[model samples]
Target chain A: MRRGPWLWAAALAVYAFLYLPLAIVVVYSFNDSRLNAEWVGFTLHWYDVLIHDEEMLLAAGNSLFIAFVSAFVATLLGTMAGMAIHRYDLKLLNFMALTPVAMPEILLGVSLLLFFIQVLNLTLGMLSIVLAHITFSIGFVAVIVRARLAGMDDSLFEAARDLGASPWETFRYVTFPLILPAVIAGGLMAFTLSIDDFVITFFTAGVGVQTLPLRIYSMIKIAVTPEVNAVSTLLMLLTLSMIVLASRFAPDVLKGKT
Target chain B: MSGPPFVFLLLFFVAPSVIMVLASFRYPGEFGGLAPLFADTQTLHGLTVETYEFFFSDIIYGYVFLKSIFVALATTLICLLLAYPLALLIARSPKKSRDLMVLLVVLPFASNFLVRVYAWMIILGPQAAFSQAVNGVLALFGMEPVHLLFSPFAVLVGMVYVHLPFMVLPLYTNLEKHDPALLDAAQDLGANVWHRFWRVTFPLSLPGIFSGSALVFIPVLGMFAIPDILGGTGDMLIGNLIKEQFLGTRDWPFGSTLSIMLTVTVLLIVWLTTRLAGRGRHYA
Candidate 1:
């Protein structure tokens, strides 16, 4: 069979559709004029403004803090759940654990907000956002880790037990070491997801508590400035780097054909 | 062993949702807040089915819900059509290029989502190069310049643009590993290109197709941002209705009803897909 020009044309056009907007954002970030409509000349004025904007910086810092903390907690719980699923026969547990993922983010966000403000009487702020993030993130981590565990050799754990090792010792020596890469990879992914979550964060966040995504949404609602473009370009770079690092540790997760 | 994770999920994820369900039954309270569901059994009197009735009886809600389904289905179909070719190209490419293409597909996830939506706003505007070029060609033909920005067309464009990668990633993953030898074998059996694709490539890619469609459809059904920024008032979907209920009207009961409706719809779709995919596997 011969390859045709039409296929290549369609593929190229799709690629252009995917990349052109990001390219435009990047290009306009350097535009001399404040308006994204016209390009006067090349300049770094927006980047300068972004750097000097304290609110954006604080929002970025808050996002990083939330991502790290939530990812850490999610990794812990997710790994425990993954190990449990691998070791135990808890069909109901597995179903319940993954339901958060199958549900919509808005539903989960509103649920958490109500539970926080009504039932628990907790304040809605950074803590609520972090809790919500961790709640959703744990499901993702468990799924990834469970995939890794399914591929792992059962003989390693059996052999350790046959060598007169205790259950905890066998897991500590063999299972933990083997699954560490997946745990770290899942954590990185959690961090990635948490950093940019907007809808969930919006519902859970209190007055004055802002993540970068929330801040960007507010800024865009008001106006789409060049500074927003600069911030977005930087956020893109940060996300790409994090994903690359995660992929390095868990290529299977990224290439997840299964 | 599973106790801790189970407890965490039951407490945070499961319980809050139960609360939402209960909250949906309570009457709209002061300032549009939900009446207290737990004050006493006497408060049970406040629980009513009016919110659910509101959704069911209102033709407006029915219209938006239908529209959301339509948009989601259209987005999924468009993504499937567009992404299949791109995924096929990537799968057939050299290893380096394949990896790069996959990276390109995933790269957009890192950028701020609002910024990406905002980018579409810029690109669709009258002053933007894409519109300018189209209008320039239109002028040569003595045609009027079309106002595409803030239209349903722009909304469709934004939805497809944002979700294209979701379709492509899964398709590429499945297609890349498919043995080209099967295609060769089909070709040797007197099959034309279309015949070979229909009999071989398309059947083998069912899993990817289902998975990709599920990924694209579920989110697009509940998506508010694209319609909010790119669409006019007519393009309002269930997502906007739910958001307005919660944030604008402070009507938690109505919002919860919409949320539950959406959740049930999403679950049904997931179940249907898995069943279909399971059938596909048995055939394979």
Candidate 2:
């Protein structure tokens, strides 16, 4: 095919736009001076500060805690739902499964807030945030697990059943092993999303329960600082590394295959 | 799926959203929160179209709403334009290259979305690397450095940059499934490259385009942080407005009404896009 110069130029421009900011962020994180524009001598002062910053460390820990717990619980429920939907002929189940994905975050956050505040008369805090995270995280896990189940050969399960295996035994010995990769991939995706979430967490979080994104948001509102750049650079690297690892080991799972 | 999952959806997703709709219709309290839905005549009977009227009639609000829609539309258009070629490239690339490209795209999505937007802040702000670079280059031409951050243009740039991957992945998947022999047959039939793309490739990629647009447009409509950080005070979008009503002004009734309005508008647009795409498919 004869390639156009204009096409290549446009693609390169877009790719640059997508990446240049991130590159700048990473570059500036190591600067000795706080001034973002000027190139100062390279130093690890900001990272050292980040290491000792107790509040930021605590917020990061809280975020990790919430993400893992929510992802684990959501994955469990998602696996059950995936098995049930695939093994049976359920009407309107697909639409129900897709509802959380389709609904806007603001809508979900507000409604969940109202339910907790008005009906349940419960104080908003980490539990509310975890509950909110689980609500959407489950949908993600279900989508991936269900896709895996669809690609799976059902005769294996039938054969297990025919060989004097109970339904639970069939699931434990055959079905579980087959869909495990998808479940792990989905769980990692969910954890990343839960950690990254700002809007839903903002609505549901109570006073003094700051996640990392919330902390960053507050800092951004106060001022744009090199510290935030440092934080973002580290986060971007961590997420990119995890995603690369997942893509390497489990390409089909990440692509929504069994 | 059968009983429990359905019940969970009904109780959580369906019921809560329905309550939000109902809450929008309720009267405003004296303190500016939502009054009782079944309040007395003094409150409920006096329910007016005032909020909607205010939103539509005020030039600032109207302009902000229009600009947001325009930004979202421009973002979607840019994403489509960029994604098509990239998707085509990935689809036609060697298998290893395709995997590498897919990994590149998926990496950004897995990261913190706010952090990525924050990354743009560092690059576009007054003291940004680009600002310095541009200032240096422009000094040769004898011009001062131009302001880039805290502007509508910056917001549009951030929106498009962040959402580009969403558009690319779907288009790549759909385009990858197409048989290459069709393109070869078109070439054999004496169709030029441009004609082949317009008549054969473009129409076949409509589903992917629709899916990508849906993915980008809906979330961009409800986005708050991107505009807040990059857009600054004067460049408020609908998301900022909705956030202000809830947090700043303590006007839950008005905020709920605005939420309802935004939700309805998005649903209408999604329906319209799908219908238009369906028509395009049929005609093509």
Candidate 3:
């Protein structure tokens, strides 16, 4: 069969559609003028301004802290759930565990906000945001870990048990080593989701708590400033590198195989 | 044990859902707000189906709901059309090249979605690069440059752009798993390229198409950012409506009603797609 010219053209066009916008953003971040349309001489003034911005730095710190803590908690809980699903075979539990990803962000955000403010009487801030992140992040981590557990060799666990190893010892000697890559992958996945989250975080992070995405949202809502472009460019670079590294290190996780 | 995650889900996920459901049935207070269930048992005495009634009775809300579905459907269809060929090409490429192509699809998703949307804003903004380029071409034909920014078209563009990768990724995954032997056997049986693809390859790819549709449709249906940023006055999606209820209108009961309705609609769509796809695969 002959490969057609149109196929290559279509693929190229799709790639362009996917990437051209980010290229434009990166290019304009260094544009010397306020108006993104006309490019004057290039300058790194936006980066200089961003480095000096106190509020943005604080927001970035809060986001990093929240992501790290939430990801850790999510990975721990999710690994437990994944093990339970593998051992127990409760189909409904499995379904319920993975359902959060399919739920809309606005719905999750609003419902959590209502629950925290009204029912729990918990003040909305970093704690609320972290809890919300864990709530959703748990679903993703469970999914990755569960996929990893499903493809695991059952004989290895049985052998450890047959050797009279205690449950803890078997897990430590056998299951832990096999699922470590997935655990790390899930942690990375949770970290990325928590960091990039906007809607759920927006609803939960009441007054005075601003993450990087929230901060960018406020700036963009007012004006598409060079500082925002600069910040976003750096954020994009950071996230892309994380994802690439994750994909390389834990290829199975990306495939939904483990 | 499953104790930790199950408890967390019940407390955080299920409990909130129950609250939203109960709140949806109550009446808004005098201030167009909802008192917490514990705050006032008095409001519970006045509990009514008024919020749901408002949703059912109001044509505006119904229109917004339908508009959300319509936009989601359109975006899904467009993404599917654009994604199928790209997925096929990537699936057919060499090993190293295929990985590169797949990375290209995923790289955009890893970036901040809001920033990508903002990129569209610049490109589609008035007097921006895209407009100037188009106008430069149109000047030869003596036609005016069309307004692309802050319009429905711009919103559609942003929606499709943001979601194209989603559609492509699932399709690529499923397509990559297709057996080349099936196509080769069909060819040996004297089936031409068109017939082989239509009879075997296309039918096998339906699962990918369905899943890709589900992935793209659900998010686009409830998406607030894309529409909020690029949309003009007339582009109110269900997400925008829910946001308005909580923040702008302070109508928590009606907001809860809308939220519940949107969730049910999304769940229904997902269920229906899986069912239909399963049936389609069986027939194929």
Residue A150 accuracy (lDDT) in model 3: 81
Model 3 per-residue lDDT tens digits across residues A166-234: 999999989999988878888898999999999899889999799999998888888878898899899
Q: Where does candidate 2 stray beyond 4 Å?
A: A1-9, A89-91, A253-258, B1-7, B36-63, B132-145
User: What would the per-residue lDDT of candidate 1 be over residues B1-284, giving only the tens digit for each residue?
Assistant: 68788888898988999999998898877777677655586556457899898889989988888899999999999999999988888888877776777777777777877777889988988877889999999999999999878899999999998888889998988888789899888888899989988888888999999999998999898888789888887889888888888888989899999989998889898999899999987776
Clashing pairs in 2: none
Model 3 residue A201 lDDT? 94
- Cα displacement (angstroms), candidate 1, residue A114, comes to 1.8
Write one digit per residue (lDDT tens) for candidate 1, span A26-117. 99999998778988999999999999999999999999999999999999998888888877856777887777776656788888887998
RMSD of 2: 2.8
Q: Which candidate is the best by TM-score?
A: 3
Candidate 1 docking category? medium
Docking quality (DockQ) for each candidate: 0.63, 0.49, 0.70
Q: By DockQ thresholds, what CAPRI class is model 3?
A: medium
Q: Rate the local accuracy (lDDT) of all candidates.
A: 0.86, 0.77, 0.86
> How do the residues A18-52 of candidate 2 rate in per-residue lDDT, one tens digit apiece?
67767777778888887677788898888988888
Kindly indicate the candidate among 2 and 3 with the higher DockQ. 3
| Ranked candidates (TM-score, high to low) | 3, 1, 2
Chain A TM per candidate, in order of listing: 0.96, 0.93, 0.96
Taking every candidate in turn, the Cα RMSD to the unseen true structure, in Å, is: 2.2, 2.8, 1.9
Instruction: Give the per-prediction TM-score of chain B.
Output: 0.92, 0.90, 0.92
